[model samples]
Target: VTSMHSLLQSATFLPQLGHNPLASGPLVLTKDGHIRGVSGDKAHIFYGIPYADPPVGAYRWKAPRALSPWPGVYDASFPRAACMQACAGPIIEECPQTVSEDCLHLNIFVPLEVNFSTPLLSSLPVLVWIHGGDFIAGSASKPLYDGRFISNFTRTVVVNLEYRLVVIILLSFSAVNKSSDM
Candidate 1:
């Protein structure tokens, strides 16, 4: 039997000729171009996709900017850092310990059957999940929020976005001043 990795590497996510409908492969595309993602029997996983620019430096206190267009296909094969937050004692390990202002990333889980040729009406429904952290802690990257199970069962697209919580709230006032100065 061919190994799953080889199968994934060789196949593209589409059902077009030269591709296998059942094979897991790199086959998703964003407006920026192609994105390398992983596929399961029922779902295609694309993680760490940046929906906005990092809110660092001058942008810290301002509204999110559009993600600058990248020159080539982005590798959405891995998870990105979660937003900055104080660790919750014993629960710290569960947190994506690494923190950054550039944590405005998201994950996408697409059912294998949903493809470019799928009609809008026949297209899979989408589920946008906002993780529960009391608006202070949780992240979309958390294990508790993994979208694979739901995507498979519902045959839908699941998108989970990570965003700054406490930091953004605290900077609201400062952002106003910074913007006025610009």
Candidate 2:
């Protein structure tokens, strides 16, 4: 059994004794737009950054389209909703309560020691994590996949991405079948 203390300690989302991101979040400008993220003791965490436009309406069952540059700073302090999926058994606890079709976002974790303002002398290794749920139910937002611990310990940049899951896949198959029958 995991103790609450240990769970809290392991949680990368919880801010530690260092920088207070609430007062002034760390800002990073990306092609899509500027993002503001939170800073923990060991890592600077950017959460729920959309890589593509929301897959809805005509966009559904199609390849994800590139996102347009947002007019203002995108607040990335909180994790976004998980892709629509049914949660069951013990795995349910690990899943986000809210789910949606517009969930193709990624979280980035950078070691706090790396100064983003200055040019890096050397490039840090990157670790991209795709959550496992047999291509169905897991989410990058799950606390189990939080990358702060790994980023700080290994001095590497970590990224966790969300992808369309079971329902979307099934719908796509159904659409294909229907179109062929037409």
Candidate 3:
């Protein structure tokens, strides 16, 4: 579970990995933060990082906007909530505690460090994620759906995106596509 292999081995093809003597053993850190490092690269990991702003109150039934950035490191140990939808059906409930209209948010996972000083290639590759369904039925907060696994394995950033549900009007007998009145 704690292997240092890149998440996207298909892309980077890290020749330095695979039982190499230089790449062996977990990294040891310095108390002074100067990094008494080795010849190879650093191990990377990502946890739960909030991808969307909380969809509460006025955010109900509206497009998901931007999230307020944090000053220091933030904890992403939780899942995004299902939008103002029932576990099924429809009813006149303003907002539920577990599910709400303000439930548009996503999460990401990325390694903390990369070989940023490489002369030929100075940065890590970008990975974007579109979650669950094709914009029909899915929440970014589902269990095991987190990108942390990808981030840890690939040692790169992984983003999980969530879009709002389509607006449909139902009149018992038939279904109708409604405009963006919300």
Candidate 4:
């Protein structure tokens, strides 16, 4: 997996890390569909994690759609794909995305101190952040506004979500999805 910067939009970044992350033991990070990385007691931080369909082609500049649920625990060792927008620098294609009719996804920033086995605290709240690239440009997946800061600052969950907020095209998304069937 690779980590890179994203363009095309501005995202709200909320740090989720606590001050004493080093006090914990190592943690696991997942991505795609496998166990990816292990962090030292220093803390395991995953960022720009993708949780949906890529915003490419017909899905470009459109509303976000439902995401494909992952089977195994995702190894969020690295960041996921950022939205597609015009940029003027060395772009990293690591999180390559194709324009398609399916383009709804979310990213997460979770703390290492917490895990499934950990007790659930009703006081904990999750903050889901929506980006403002409008349509055609902008991605919550951008690297700069990622998990490191949040996982180190707060105990809450920070999610960078990508959704469709675009000017309606002449044809509806139904037609777009149909075309892909062929």
Candidate 5:
């Protein structure tokens, strides 16, 4: 029989650290299906988790709604497309090459030591970082937004969330305001 310690050390053992773990190891089942994240020595990172359905097509210009579940174990190891925005900076390069309307994603970093046996109230506090973009453009994928170093140092869980930018969301609000003025 595999020793418990060895099993714990196994890549598949989740120890119920956070969310629901699937049987495939390093894989979690959220409200959606199985999601595979990356495991670091200090923390387990889940990236590009969708909180809402893609704000495209008929959903465009509408408030966010529940996210539709995906079919398979979604690979969440990489960041998704940043919210739609014009390219800036010296190079003036657009991120992801293809911006999408469905860019509502979040990245979560959890300390490796966090486990179910730990008291819920005593568990490490979670810090959520909302990157500043002047309400326009920024992404959780940016280097300045990385949560790994701080999470390791503080032994705290860190979350980075992405949302629609000013161009997309503000335009809709302005239209509504104009209509209301009439």
Candidate 6:
């Protein structure tokens, strides 16, 4: 079985021949499901793809569960909410106003030249960027993290991912410790 990490790591060269002519964006079929991403001048941008189930309710304070294959084409043209966090200050406009537990999403930027003709083992390198936030704040949806220019200029696939932070991490550790005492 292909691990999710490897699947995403190699997603750069996936065939892009599944475009829906009636849709406004490009379509890419992943193991999880079909996703529609916007087409940019230099890259194809897929945003807010869920890598795992929402870390809410009973799932809270526990490890994230793998996402099952979704039934339909997921609209990945727009960014999703960032994981719950506080804005650093007034000038941090990139901080998303919406925050939720269901924020374990990732964004992918693929160069325009990488098409169906490209082999799955294409020579292009993949860059996986995990945001730095002192374990308290940060989001993959930040405009500064957009990978279009990097993907286009470097001729590579770029991926950015969002993860739980601060309170969530603390709660998780506390839960684990308490459970271990049982």
TM-score of each: 0.76, 0.82, 0.45, 0.48, 0.73, 0.85
TM-score ranking from best candidate downward: 6, 2, 1, 5, 4, 3
lDDT of 4 at 177: 67
Query: lDDT tens string, model 2, 90-152?
Result: 877766788899988888888888655565566677778899998869899888899999999
lDDT of each: 0.66, 0.75, 0.39, 0.44, 0.67, 0.79
Clashes of each: 0, 0, 9, 25, 0, 0
The residue-by-residue lDDT of candidate 1 on 1-182, one tens digit each, is 12222223222333331222453455544444555677766677788877776778977777777766566767877778888876678867766767788888878787666554433344456677888876777788787888888988887667887877875677677668667466
**Superposition TM-score, candidate 5 onto the true structure:** 0.73
- For candidate 3, what's the RMSD? 12.0
Instruction: Give one digit per residue, the lDDT tens place, for model 4 in 1-182.
Output: 02211210111221211222343322332333322333423334444345444546666535444344357655545545444444334543432354323434455555555543344454344566666543545566555456546754687655665544433343445566677554
> Candidate 6, residues 27-115: lDDT per residue as tens digits?
87887788888989878889998888788998887778888788999999999988987666764675668889999888988887776
User: Which residue runs does candidate 4 get wrong by more than 4 Å?
Assistant: 1-73, 86-103, 165-182
> Candidate 3 regions off by >4 Å?
1-55, 68-74, 86-98, 112-121, 167-182
**Runs of candidate 5 exceeding 4 Å displacement:** 1-25, 89-98, 114-122, 174-182
Which model, 1 or 6, shows the larger TM-score?
A: 6
Best by TM-score: 6
lDDT over C-alpha atoms for residue 159 of model 5: 80
Ranking by lDDT: 6, 2, 5, 1, 4, 3
In candidate 3, what are the lDDT values of residues 61-107, reduced to their tens digit? 34445545444324333444555443344423322236544454444
- Model 1 poorest ten-residue lDDT run: 1-10
